[model samples]
Target: MTEMTRRDAPAAIRAIGHVSTLCGVVAAALIFVSVLITCQMIFLRAVLGQSTVWQTEAVIYMMIGATLLGLPYVQKLRGHVGVDLVPGLLPAGARKALALAVLSATIVMIGLMLFYGWEMFHLAWERNWRSETVWGVKLWIPYLAVPLGFALFALQLVADLWAVATGHDDADPNVAPEDRRH
Candidate 1:
């Protein structure tokens, strides 16, 4: 293992990181769109005294999509909460081992989610499922986000694992910089 940063990451890892950044941007856009729709819905219902049909359902789907699709970006930024007390106490070699183990476990879990998510999406598409609401949006469209998000998330996890294995990661965040492996 050697000391490295994202700039030193392999091309594939960097590519994944780029995609994660794109996802983050798109997630922010989705949130913005949801907010705009909510405002419009409020205006129509209150000021204009008009009944809204699709606004509520659309907002819900957009929010869920934003959350799922934002996963890879969050992982890329290491924004998720972590408990690193034990890793911080370990020596460099053991710390690296722990990072590998945790990353591997997470990848496997996300892989499962991707698999099942795709299955659900496939079923919805094949069955031509639609929401029962007045808007009657196609279920597959919203469900598509699930598998897509998990897949990107899994890719990000793989990139993270690569970083750890290659010593590109500052594995134990709780450790002092001077104490970390060089």
Candidate 2:
């Protein structure tokens, strides 16, 4: 095949990156909301002798969304921590195989999550389930993260799979943990 062009090499990955940047925005917003709510609660308790009940739950769910949705982005950026336990001992082809296996497992896991997440969101939507707080927030409020996050995760996984399948000697996520630091 033709030598991969600049656009070819980074298309899906850049798209995933844009989406991850969006997730980063959302995560920052969620964290900001959490901080605001905490401060609000403290101010309210100081002034009015009580705070809103739903704010606590709202902040918690937002944090969860932020964290899980940001995971794939973190993975993409090499921000997440890990140890080089596997690649330390494996050979080249064996390392490639392990990389494929890793990508495949991620695909399967994300696929399963997307499948079950759809069902869960559907059930919540159909039943009009409510949150467990003073406010009657819909259950799907927090549930949105599952499908959205997993779908984005699946996209990133595909990018990873493509890089691996292309047999690139040097690619993202291909370098073992040890090779990275050295």
Candidate 3:
């Protein structure tokens, strides 16, 4: 297939979008759980004079997971704010080159995150790190979310870079609101 056609390929683009959508759903669920936990913490503190020590940490981890996990979805939704002001002045080719550069930089950054996160995960596991809380949930488990999210984000960024470099815009329109997909 031609480069343009390949970039716009529905199946390929949708596959990437599906990952983003799935992550978004996970993020949403985590947010909901976090809300419930917050409510529980509030009620217990007010009425029972006690709250689970792990609640705050759990919320923090969940929020982190939600943010990282939701990144690809936000990218899919074209919700990221970009200063295209300067690019607008350039020719289409130059603009796309800039996009490619941005995507490449993103991949490198995420790759580093994934690599260091893996190292951290290994260290945490080796040391059997536990949160300083009653529940003592394994710290490593929550930290794994970092690498997982980075991996998925890297994949999405590659897809985006591929599209930009090839001058293909095969992104799904339905994934994001029409007005927002620009």
Candidate 4:
């Protein structure tokens, strides 16, 4: 690789890493909001003898959204479950190839997810679908998290692939030497 290209790769990786981190923060906030709403719902039911309307549905959507949005961040942290036993036994060259193959397969899977997710979100939006619950909240709004999350996840996967292919796997501080092989 040219010196300039090598220099740019790490920089690009860092930028993508920042985006993943921001997504993590957003995911955390969504969970926090869901928790707060749940607490409020409990208080309303127990103390005020009032039934909740949107709280339950809202919490469910937010929790799902949080899980979706947290994907890239989890990958970034190498928090996803992985077995390094096979890769660990391989020579450096073989290990690198394995990493490339695994990363490539992951990217393709996430891309498929992104495509279908977008399709689902688009259908819901075009049909003006709404939840059947008392809240009758718009389905597209929450459905959007599907595509958005997968897109972010694919981006992170591409970054990881690039790092591995270019011998810059250390771009992510969370990546240990053993994890890099996988």
How do all models score by TM-score? 0.92, 0.82, 0.85, 0.89
Error of 3 at 169 (Å): 1.8
Ranking, lDDT, top scorer first:
1, 4, 3, 2
lDDT of each model, Cα atoms only? Answer: 0.87, 0.73, 0.77, 0.86
Model 1 lDDT tens row, 106-145: 9999999999999999999999999999999999999999
- Candidate 3 local accuracy as lDDT? 0.77
lDDT of 2 by residue, 49-132 (tens): 985777778788888898878867765664656555775577767777777787799799889989898789888999999976
The regions of model 4 sitting more than 4 angstroms off are: 1-9, 171-182
Q: What's the lDDT for residue 115 in model 1? A: 95
Cα displacement (Å) at residue 82, model 1: 0.9
Off by over 4 Å in 2: 1-8, 167-182
Residue-level lDDT of model 3, residues 1-182, one tens digit each, is 23445556567666887898899999999999999999999998998998577789899999999998888888776677877578657765666667677778889988999899888888888999998878898988988888888888888787777655554553321122232324
- Which tens-of-lDDT digit does each residue in 1-182 have in candidate 4? 22444466678887888999999999999999999999999999999999999999999999999999999998888788899799867777778888889989999999999999999999999999999998999999999999999999999999988887877664333344644333
Which window of 10 residues has the lowest lDDT sum in candidate 2? Answer: 1-10
TM-score of model 2 relative to the true fold? 0.82
Clashes (backbone N, CA, C under 3 Å), per candidate, total: 0, 0, 0, 0
Q: Cα deviation in Å at residue 75, candidate 1?
A: 0.2
Q: In model 4, what is the error at residue 55, expressed in angstroms?
A: 0.4
Off by over 4 Å in 3: 1-7, 170-182
Give per-residue lDDT, candidate 4, residue 162.
88
